[model samples]
Target: MGEFAQILRAWRDRVRPEDVGLAPGLNRRAPGLRREELALITGVSVDYIVRLEQGRAVNPSPQLLTSLTRALRLNDAERDHLFRVAGAAAPSSGLVPRQVTPSAQRMVDRFRNAPVAVAVHTAIYELVLWNPLWAVLFGDPSSQSRLERNVAWQHFAGSLPVTHTPEDDEAYSRDLVGHIRAASGRYPADPDIPRLIDRLVEASPDFARRWKAGTVGELRTSRKTLHTEQVGDVVVDCDTFSGGPGDQTIVVMTAAPGSEDEQKLDLLRVVGLQRLGS
Candidate 1:
């Protein structure tokens, strides 16, 4: 095997199945991730993984490499090493990073059973790393495309079926655009932000209008109404906590304790798990 292939094999061997949210089955000989498991988590085909590991696929794109880095749970130094071995450029500093830090991952894991929905989002508002309650409250964000996973894209693109007052909806739309503007300003050279902004401008007239308005705002705690198919309208408080150089935000959704909304949320949790299992 070539140097790149060798390095890839070593990294794959270092990642435990449980580390990436998989159960280690009985009769398994490998200590780390199987190639199939790695491919599943990375959103690539098993055949592609095999070709890459055999040195037949030498030039993986930066995006593919980034996804592999996350699936393998590589640290900064290791991620850079992966890039170097792949003959690709290491991700530049100050880019809108999608990789959730180990600390941030642990933070979300701690809230596994909390009676609230929690998720981590990139500065560009890409949804990454969400708890099960978040799936219950917001539907399955995992099914969304990379751009569709973005909150701004969801609102402006009219993909998410959210219910709000006309005035509040307009305000929320403006706030989302403004937040994206702020993120763009903070990370001017991030390649993905420009493409996303350009696409949003082309796809939605509302987004085009708001982008020209140039409003700026930070995401703060607020109460919003969510409409679900299983339940009717659920009102919850939305809170955002920011971390990392990329300005990733941890979003938490909660209803008042002992309130009817909280009861509905509890029911939703059970329903969500059932849907996942089925």
Candidate 2:
């Protein structure tokens, strides 16, 4: 089994939906941390978190681990335990699987106006089925191996290809990464993310300095300034929805009304479609 898988199992078994303050429900199949619930608490997407727990991803970063830890509400003792589970030296890059259940997939489809995505508590955000605009806005980037299309990586790495000042770039990166940080308690042992941490520390002084200061906790809503080539700058409100197979979250983001987000969405969608076209 992958390192994160064991840790994921531990996280799942140790948590009850309501223990983390989620309402109790009767439809859960995975027992704990439905990928969507985990994503909501951890501020990751259900799809991404699912892969981390299932061993689909091989590496995750320490910062992301911290986020998952925070989201899961694990104390320092439990946090350390997760690190041990992931094997101090494994990569932290993992992807949540994309098999949305029939009902869940229908729910995603119904979220037509929302730019929604799902991730696991482990910080794996998968584009289960996004709206048409979202498909374009968060288009597949060449910068990623099929694996790196995870939204968090795109926004943080500043590789989403939106044209904006460096100022916007930094803010986008922070929120993207911060959301992951917020969910640290659940997915402490992702595979490739640890290596990404090493790279970020080596590459960006800003992230290097703030990496240690990451705020960990159950994710709540936050604002992000985005730079879309089409929409100059837009502030988006990210809302999280939890409950699913277990402990996962589906995060739906919408630009505040009157924002250029719609235009930006159109642009991203256009460009993304072009890329997908080629």
Q: Rate the local accuracy (lDDT) of all candidates.
A: 0.83, 0.55
Q: How many backbone clashes does candidate 2 have?
A: 71
- Candidate 1: misplaced stretches above 4 Å? 24-31, 45-51, 54-57, 109-115, 163-171, 191-195, 198-213, 257-260
For 1-278, candidate 2 gives per-residue lDDT tens digits of 77668777676666767555466688767666677777775566787777887888756666566556644656545666676665553222333223333344345445543443322222444333344555544553333453465555444444664444476555545655565564443556654556666656676566666677784333455555555556566556666665454235566667655556655654555665466557
In TM-score terms, candidate 1 sits at 0.79
- The lowest-lDDT stretch of 10 consecutive residues in candidate 1 is 158-167
lDDT of 1 by residue, 1-278 (tens): 99889888998998788777677888888798999999987889999999999999978998899888877777888888899989998877878877777667766766665678888999888998898878876678778788878888888885665566687677778878888999899899888999999999999998999899898986766778878777788888888886563468888888999998888888887777777768
Q: Tell me the deviation in Å of residue 228 in model 2.
A: 4.4
Clashing pairs in 1: none
lDDT, model 2, position 78: 65
- Give the CA lDDT, 0 to 100, for residue 118 in model 2: 26
